[model samples]
Target: MKKRAAFLIGTGCVLIAVSASLAVNNQLESLKAEKSAELLTEAFISRTTVFETSVTEMTNEPVPEIIADNEIRGADEQASAKKPIIIDGQEFIGLLSIPSLGVSLPVNNDISYPLLKMTPCRYFGSVDSDSLIIAAHNYNSHFGKIGMLKPGDRVNFTNAGGLIETYAIAEVLTLPGDAVDEMIKPEGWALTLFTCTYSGTERITVRCVKEERI
Candidate 1:
């Protein structure tokens, strides 16, 4: 009888030990999974942050060499024009960075066909006398995230004098491409962004107002 009792006690202890081990293993696995998810999120945020900084730097850069060609200048003007600072690279036109929506692009050039001939990038920033009309590709690979902008989001670019131009989102409007007349209602200097809507190719335009900045 004593031997039988001893055998039963030993069996109970072994089962308890096995159950405890399994529980610990499961807990460790759960923790590991959570850590992995956290790491992935951090990585994505970091990548976007870096992309924004890079795009902004690109925007702050001088004008593109293609546009700076003095050869076209009336032969005599090129000599005394102060060697027009010439810039090259896609970044010269890059100006805006939307982190929340993972968008960083150069908001340079007018809405004319000739500039589009310069590069296939999203274009904005006024030329001569006009408020900038920003346009981006509706495709997800480009500035499609502009649709995600909300009130208070930021829009940045640089002026002809190499000064950073900043604007804030005051409102978002879902309007037609021809609605261009309605976009200038913002109170301050503004950057009007337009693109095809997510559900359809209909243009989606959002205007951001300029706020105290050099």
Candidate 2:
């Protein structure tokens, strides 16, 4: 009967392990859903006043180029004329919407673990400047489905100042993670958002250009 008792104990342990794993998975999904809801509410409803205040405060500050390494690059006289509005308490630039992909997420000015888990990040450039490069983790709700975007798809960038810039997708390409310098360079005014592939071997880049301002 000793062997029989051991088998029953082993079965109990296996059942306990499976239950714990299932609980953890449910919690993670709940957290993801909660975070997405928070972003949608913040992007569409709240934070409008906060963004306007941020714009006023940063209106005179220099528009520093934020490179891949977060270094301030050479000055663009034209860009410097506009203010860099990402303030201490108010780091979010605005909401980025790709209707085709059903992506409507808040955009933080800086890339960090806490910020990325909550929303996409503006790694470099700005809405009013030459190029804007945003990044996100390859979650299904984030930039994971960006590969499905085709040329001519519309991408909307809504700034804190209540201004919306509509962009037309121009190209979707993949590049090595080491190509930070090349990625930040703008051929002209454009918007770029990237996420790593599932294997993390390369970055999938979606490039868009301003088609209209509203």
lDDT of 1 by residue, 1-214 (tens): 9999999999999999999998787466545433432342233224331222333333344334433343455645433221212233222333455545654443333344433322223344352223666665554434456777898876655332233456677777788656645655543445677777865547777777775343
Please give, for residues 1-214, the per-residue lDDT of candidate 2 as tens digits.
9999999999999999999998798568646944763655354435463233222212223222221111232345223323323433446667677878776776777788766776788898877674888998777677879988999988876565445567889999998988887688757748998998767888999989888654
Best by TM-score: 2
TM-score of 2: 0.66
How well does model 2 score by local distance difference test? 0.68
Residue 17 lDDT, candidate 2, scale 0-100? 100
Point out where model 1 deviates above 4 Å.
1-94, 108-130, 159-162, 183-189, 199-201
Report, for every candidate in turn, its global Cα lDDT versus the true structure. Answer: 0.50, 0.68
lDDT, candidate 1, equals: 0.50
